[model samples]
Target: MPAVLVLLLLSGFLSRAEAATVVARVDLSSQRMTVSVNGVPRYSWLVSTARRGYVTPTGVYRPQRLYRMYYSRKYYNSPMPYSIFYSGGYAIHGSYAVSQLGGPASHGCIRLHPSNAATLYSLVQSYGRGNTAIVITR
Candidate 1:
């Protein structure tokens, strides 16, 4: 019985380790962002994308850098915290005004609620820098 129990525990551990390390999906048309773990949805939030003319690009990208603090020149003094730099100049970052979510408002990046961004930052840290995959689709 003890041997069987040990085997079961090991299997559970291996399963978790085998789980996918990357898990974020963005829907451009709906302007929604969903985060998952091992293929299970963990968090879902409304988001704003680039304006009608400046549409957010749809592609597969990985997080290449993380900035606990960042500033946006376009927004003037407005700063973005817990910024996860994904594509070229685009990123998933915290916003001061979350009320703008679910609208087409961003320049070319994914915006998250301040609280949600903080949580995501922690998750990325655990997943390892430059290891998270983000999939954007229409």
Candidate 2:
């Protein structure tokens, strides 16, 4: 009975690990984001990264924090909804500037349409940070 219980626990753990795998890949050159779950592409959305004078760091990262709504302290209290902060102050968040998506316009963060941001926020929350990855590339 103990062995059977152990097997059940292990199977549950393995299933969660497999089901929770989430990846958000950002392409800087094209200003697009692709979201995948368990190795299957699920969403492709436009994104806005750093403007002419700013830079969006490129690398792989795990989400550091999640916020339903956040105000940027460095950028004049701009509203950042459904924020998934991956780096120090850099995040993937909802922006009101929908027209600026698919182009470079932010100070240095990745911006997405409000609904897309909410979707991503929900995915990351459901999966947990350890099971999610954020990859930014040129």
lDDT of 1 by residue, 1-138 (tens): 223223323645223333335467889889888887545578988888898677578876677888898997766856889988887778889887788998888888898888888888898899775446677888
Clash counts for the predictions, in order? 0, 0
Off by over 4 Å in 1: 1-19
Give candidate 2 regions above 4 Å deviation.
1-20
lDDT of 1: 0.75
How far off is model 1, as Cα RMSD? 8.2
lDDT at residue 104 of model 1 (Cα atoms):
82
Error of 2 at 104 (Å): 0.2
TM-score of 1: 0.80
